[model samples]
Target: MDDQSPPRKGCCSLRCGLALLLHFCNVSMMSQRACLSLTMVAMVNATDAQGLPNASTQEPPGDLRNPVYNWSPKIQGLILSSITYGMLVAQVPVGYLSGIYPIKNMVGSGLLLSSLLSLLLPLAAGAGASLVLACRVAQGLSQGTVLVAQHTVWTRWAPPAERGRLTSMSLSGLMLGPSVALFATGHICQALGWPVVFYIFGACGCALSLSWFVLFYDDPKDHPCISLGEKELITASLPEQVGSGGKSVPIKAVLTSLPVWAISLSCFAYSWTNHIMFLYLPTFISYRLRVDVRENGLLSALPHLCSWLLSILAGHAADGLLARKRLSLIAIRKLFTTLGLLLPALLVMGLLYLGSGFRGTLSLLTLTSATLGFCTAGMMINPLDIAPRYYGFLKGLTILIGMTGGLTSSTLAGIILNQDPVSSWFKIFFLMAAINVTSLVFYLIFAKAEIQDWATEKQHTRL
Candidate 1:
């Protein structure tokens, strides 16, 4: 009879545990789906802005004479890549402002401004490179502001156990934009002039802004649709918010933190690798593979589309590992961070040394591109790990540092190609590989997601 009682109790415990997990899984799936839907919309918006068609309806731009993408590849790359420069300059201010103002308000304002600016882009293009750059700068700054706020809001709403999936779901925008843009832009450029793309994007941006304002709230407490029990769970699960009176973190402390530096360095590496792929891959396909414009666009998108799928898988894996509590934080971070960089570097290097034909180069490039999805694990969650209270500010700092990779890479690629187009690409690939590897070293040595004792003590002092 005593043995029977013990078995009954154990059965009850197992049932309760399963019930709790199922509930968490349901909530997490709902949250992730919302984020994923948002990402899909954002990607469509970004793609249209980059002069892409709405979907698969149009053809890629071609010269009346040649009937292929007519814009100078280099100049087109410049047009696409210029946004990062504005984004970098805007991040710090955006971060600081978000801490003082409500995150929802910041996003609302950014979307409004971006919608207006995006409308002006088609008109601005005929004004020359300066005007185009000006519009891009405005768009980039607005996007940066919105993104800082978005990060802050996600941290507040997402549960601890579900953050990885939520973060990756949101970040799917990053990959989705490039994939959709490459495919659609080629068609849009073919069907209408590239300018028409901006008109479509601007109109869509306006619509999205309306939805965002209507649907989004800064905190779960403020969300009318949110359940009281879920709200309680979120608030209780979070570590206490840091700093004084909800004030911005001191710029100096953030600048000096070793962990921050590591995160920033890793971000730079990731950005360098990513932008190289985004900005150059199409041209590489056109020039090296001798593929037609439409085929090139479709092929280029394949790697990023693959990456988008893999990132979601990686996010779930991260959460499952956490739930099991089998790996130390350091081990977990190192596993993802190292593989993310090292594998891509190796693949890129192999392409440089051994790639001979179109098939070989494409295969190597795809593999390199796919490995980047692995970095989503560390990149998505590190902010919460190190300073959950200040995720927005940290993301701002990281973006400021990381986006330099675009400015430098574009400038350097231009310089190198000026001297010799073919040989220069090889050198650039090697350099990218080296940067990726060096960043891994920094991450392994110093990057940590755990809140520091000093930050915790500061929180107490504020209280």
Candidate 2:
């Protein structure tokens, strides 16, 4: 199939508008991660008016406490950890369902659930850490389902030639969400209490979820406003099996595919390294760089802004290369994947070795993250490359594998920094560099962009 030819005709403008749907979805759900982190920072340094622990005291704040001064670090960790656990448990089932059912409904419900849960976070915390953990877990489960289902849904909507551009544009919300969340949440914390963080994000989620149901459709065939020409263009451009493959799944073939493993392993590595930045970078800056808490959000958002802009450019570049037939799909995917992981790995080491002043260090880290953004053009688009029919399922598998980065990387950091996290920054940076290198090796050896035979061959479909 000619996956990279110019469009024969323009699709409905609404088709383009549909990208904004996921764009908003990405922004709303992804914001929660950074928002909660910002809130945690506030709570950690908070002390009561009387110098006791109290969440209610702004005049004389107290540390995060059960009553007025007794919150345990262990409990804090538990509340955060539950979300990861929820994501791990629900991803497979959600992925499976998205492929067979109406993905719009699944994704919409997930968003709605997560938004509602966000509203309850402050209440859950008031009840105690265990209750808070449960709420976070619920949020995680919903988010996992919604995010994994995205490629599956996009598979139906995106033409093969433009997949990278469209996907990246939607995924750009990932970058924008945290960038805004950190800064906005920080400022909001100063003016209002921490609970407002949840309320604000929750409101955004609620609004976007409503927009999704109204604007989104499962397939081009189902869109009420699609013109005949656009509908034909979309349907003909799509791989045949996408509409048909869900009825039968080749479990063993998919599970054992070398490309799948390569993608999964690479995802694991990327997630591990990125999770360090996502979850711990703010903490690291506060303790090691001696940044003030109020400014942490704005500073932390810098890398994300760099990443967001770079990813947009990378996506257009990848699509342009394919459209011009300047490179084979496999070569394009491989080259960019290498660029994404390889440069970041090396630059991160440079960041560690240079020990440049704060500005220089931030510049290097920004460049490294910008390099990582190229993965938006590479592995992030691979499931659509190989398995349009089962794209969601494959995406779910990779994400499930990738999320271990959350548990494993953070746990490693905890162990390595048992004495003092500030002093242990070198170890953390080195570990991230090593992970990036390992993922690059695995990807170079095994990842493939060609459609797997099992995707289209009926004889193997039932396994």
Candidate 3:
């Protein structure tokens, strides 16, 4: 996997970075949209009347308190939870189609549609909760293809040895996206209004969409900005995967493959803890540990920051190991992914013993995110390892699978946190630990780096 020459300077890599930055912007908007409760809590919680926070003392609807959509906990949860439904229904189909169309078109055009949907949120909310739910779901449908579309670009853009770094770099946007959402939404809510959150982010998405189509090409050979020599390098680097972009996907084989299942389930386990902690950590810090709500808000950001920094670090390290030939790809992926899962599991286990030592628990919780991020090198990059050409579909499948785990974890959190006992919280953390262990076992047993036969042009459709 060693390269004949060092990677070309400031061509595809730069374009890749900018494309992913746009992707992160869309993700940030979605995360902000889902957690409308947080940014608009000031407006919504103005009265005790059905979840409004004293609308009488606060300014009128158009005056001081505005984001009145999330006025009830039930409606807020439903509105927040509805986007996943769209993604669940759309991802597999979209993943398949991304290979057939220009990936830039898929990403750029799709994201613009989602942004436009964001612009409609206020109107939708003004109409009714059902209208708002429909709007969010439509946005999710537009974005459901994003995972596949992003990975499809990487097939042509990233070399085998370089994929660990490049894919990680691109995918790390997942972390950076929410981090931006959390920070940006907070400031905008205070300065402008809750409705402006949708407007501003939606406008940014449209802007990024224009740049994406203008700056990127699905294949290096197709990029006007790329040099002949750089195009030659990329073309030569991905010999097996070249020209596989338009090949038909072998759906039956994909659905039945064992390695696919292993990776997908492993991803499920990782997503479970990650999303649950992200959604509930603030509540745990504020209510369980009795930290002031304002301080808890700031502290909740620590885990995401840790994951973002660690993921970038792990990406470089993984690529370096691949280039130096110090370890096999399987070994390197296992090492990184196992650390991502096992270390966090151990930390969660430790939380059970901390009792009420709130400071220690917060520190451990933040540390868990850093370890969880090691998956960027491990399972996150596995799609490229197994089938570079079909990476979009494989990656989409893994994410689709992970959504189930996310739902399960979220449900468990709702039940346990509602019960509100230190011991009940302990059981949930222990469950997260056990799930991580199960994923490690599955990955160790079944994961593979070699391309699956069904994805090969010559040997496709075995199923």
Worst 10 residues of 1 by lDDT: 29-38
Q: Per-residue lDDT for 1-463 in model 1, tens only?
A: 1222331121133222222332222222112111211122222332342345433234233222112222343555466666767788889778666666776677767766776776785556545657766877777787777666566755666667766666666665566555665666556644664555555556666666666667667666676655555556667776564322265465566777888888889889988888787667765676678765557667787777777677767777887787799776656666777877899899998987895787898889888888888777775468768776667777888877888975688677766765686598888889999999998898889887678654554543321
- Ranking the candidates on lDDT from highest down gives 2, 3, 1
Query: What TM-score does candidate 1 get on C-alpha atoms?
Result: 0.81
- TM-score of every candidate relative to the true structure: 0.81, 0.91, 0.89
Each candidate's number of clashing pairs is 10, 9, 6
The prediction achieving the highest TM-score against the true structure is 2
Candidate 3 clashing pairs, residues 3+ apart or interchain: 45-53, 46-53, 46-54, 47-52, 47-53, 47-54
lDDT of each: 0.64, 0.76, 0.71
Candidate 2 lDDT, 309-374, residue by residue in tens: 888788889999999999989788888888888888888789878866888778887787677778
Backbone clash tally (model 2): 9
Which pairs clash (backbone N, Cα, C closer than 3 Å) in model 2?
A: 46-62, 46-63, 47-61, 47-62, 48-60, 48-61, 48-62, 53-68, 53-69
User: In candidate 2, how many Å is residue 269 off?
Assistant: 0.9
